[model samples]
Target chain A: MTPATPRRRGRPSRTESADTPAARDRILAAAREEFSERGYDKTSVRGIAKAAGVDSALVHHYFGTKEQVFEAAITLSFAPAMEAPRTVEEGPLDGVGERLTRFIFGVWENPATRKPLLAIVRSAVNNEAAAAVFRRIIVTQVLRRIADRLDVPDAELRAELAAAQLVGIAMLRYVIKVEPLASADPEQIIKRVAPVVQAHLTGPGL
Target chain B: MTPATPRRRGRPSRTESADTPAARDRILAAAREEFSERGYDKTSVRGIAKAAGVDSALVHHYFGTKEQVFEAAITLSFAPAMEAPRTVEEGPLDGVGERLTRFIFGVWENPATRKPLLAIVRSAVNNEAAAAVFRRIIVTQVLRRIADRLDVPDAELRAELAAAQLVGIAMLRYVIKVEPLASADPEQIIKRVAPVVQAHLTGPGL
Candidate 1:
């Protein structure tokens, strides 16, 4: 080993040559796999670091803690779809419902991307800590972003109600697997649900 | 003890004088508490019997297995609101959404009744057996009845969608406790949610 090579105090040998941006992405991906397979409570930091072929200190160096790792995984899972909220920023408010519905449905209906989200929702249903983290992500990363694009009164409440409608459908579709909704035409669901979402976003109250 | 009284085999001394309809109700209530406090995998018949202060055999006599006890408790928890399907039986179809939403919100928003229902939802999320039972009840006791009342072409699909929406809202408001929706006024929620639900029940597709 070169004496000039940087070494940390009480740290294990590096699993790879050096840290790079790709290393952080690799760690996040490994975290996703571990969390989705075993859920929040069962996954460990060392396990994720090992799977990522990085030192345990490297895992801690990148994400700091297991909870933070999960948070970053959520960002990785959702960052693509989170851009949909920004779609609301540029488009007519009327199309927001269809755009939003199609966005979420498109993301969740795909098995590859759906695994981590499913793990998070199922974990949140039973574990308080997971639920807290899940809630923070949904509220801050997703709903609040969409609400910020709106000019409506009570935008925050409307944003959440809109979220509830879609979240509920996803729960029945994926978690509870309620038939019809579980297997019904996604376009049909979007058609039926979009108007309500639009109304929540910009309609006069009853 | 009187010789006149007949005792069942392998039974503990009568926990109470004799079985009555009220005794059955007590057993059902105790079963609800056990299943709700602990998820399905953790709850047992003996624990329920002990909680109800009855012999374990008496519990078996009333409800055959752990699954049966769970179904009965779900039935008991849902029976009051299950009648909303009947509201559709007599009311105009357009108002079915409002009636249905009002009924569920009434049941769930009230803490006294929400406990058992919450247990069922949380339990169903993780336990396949509990999920099966919950699905059966949602299909036969709830959605099917509402669907039967409709003359729409895809009544069953529509019924399930409506269920998806309400179930999602209930999940957010109570289970996940998402902000805004969680604290939103029940009546206001019904007002806002009703129209969307109505559209899902009766809309022309996109």
Candidate 2:
């Protein structure tokens, strides 16, 4: 073998990149569709790879395992919850309810966020792994930060209560597609529901 | 030859009796347990019969099909919505909010009601048939009655809005088990949440 000769990798033909973000996104999109349509128990890694137009080996390379893929999907869907604390931190504490409401509505209303959110909701209801991921995200990243910032006793409780209310509304309006709620104007919902959420977040009483 | 023998089929065997309400209840209870644990798709007549300690033939005799069994199970669970109109009708319109709240909280808080309710919720989230049944009950029995009683221009909208808020709260507390909201005392919940529910039910402004 010539020392100066460049060694070529096997099967280096069309579109061979070192695991680009675009490939990861494509895999995620395909995974969401697979999970949503076929459910967690039914969807397979090879199926996700075929849908994503990537090699089955590449999927394992990127995500490690189907469980890890699912975790990635869940974490991707709940990215907003991670950002919510920072957003809350920047806003006035006095109107935390309003700010929280608007932020939640804004994220949920956006198509980019809503699709993954729908996936998360559906997965959480159907899959224990998805639910555990959701619980961890909500407890650690979302509620913990909000609770820490709260100045009242039982702040954690209040934060969770507030989360329940907000998430419950999202569940009805978005996932369940409950008619009038699904059709209700975002502004109208925010106006009516924000105060209740606000009260739970920072209001008086146990 | 059978006619000559006069084969007895009057009330049928105790295990096969379909006319008795106890048989109906047992079948329904089994359906609830099977549907809750396995979901609607995985639950079957044989599974329900196995759980109920009866033959599949007896299950079919009592309820025509799996769909019928599911219907019966749902009706049994959702009977409270039927009674809601009657209960709300007995009280003044102004107090409807408080009465409705108390009734809802009572139903959800009761083990008798909660189990079937949970079954319905799980089925609705997972199965199309169950969702249809849930939608029908809400629109006809629950929302229609409430909307008819309201003088608001968007009475239907208001009724649905009220449902969304209450159902949302229930979803979080019962299904998702979201921390404090899940564990909060029913009295404390009612005291704080009833007013918001009341506002949605009969508050000023559409």
Candidate 2 chain A least-lDDT 10 residues? A1-10
Candidate 1 structure quality by residue, lDDT tens digits, A78-164: 666677687677788878888888888888888876776777776777767777777888888878888888865688889888887
Query: What Cα-based lDDT does every candidate model obtain?
Result: 0.77, 0.74
Cand. 2 Cα-lDDT: 0.74
lDDT of 1 at B157: 82
Model 1, B1-45: lDDT tens digits are 001222234433564533767678878877887787776767899
Cα deviation at B60, candidate 2, in Å, is 8.3
Clashing pairs in 2: none
How many clashes does the backbone of model 1 have? 1
Backbone Cα, N, C clashes tallied per candidate: 1, 0
Best by lDDT: 1
TM-score of 1: 0.82
Q: What is the DockQ of candidate 2?
A: 0.24
| Model 1 stretches astray by more than 4 angstroms | A1-30, A42-66, B1-27, B45-62, B203-206
Off by over 4 Å in 2: A1-31, A44-68, B1-34, B44-69, B85-87, B92-98
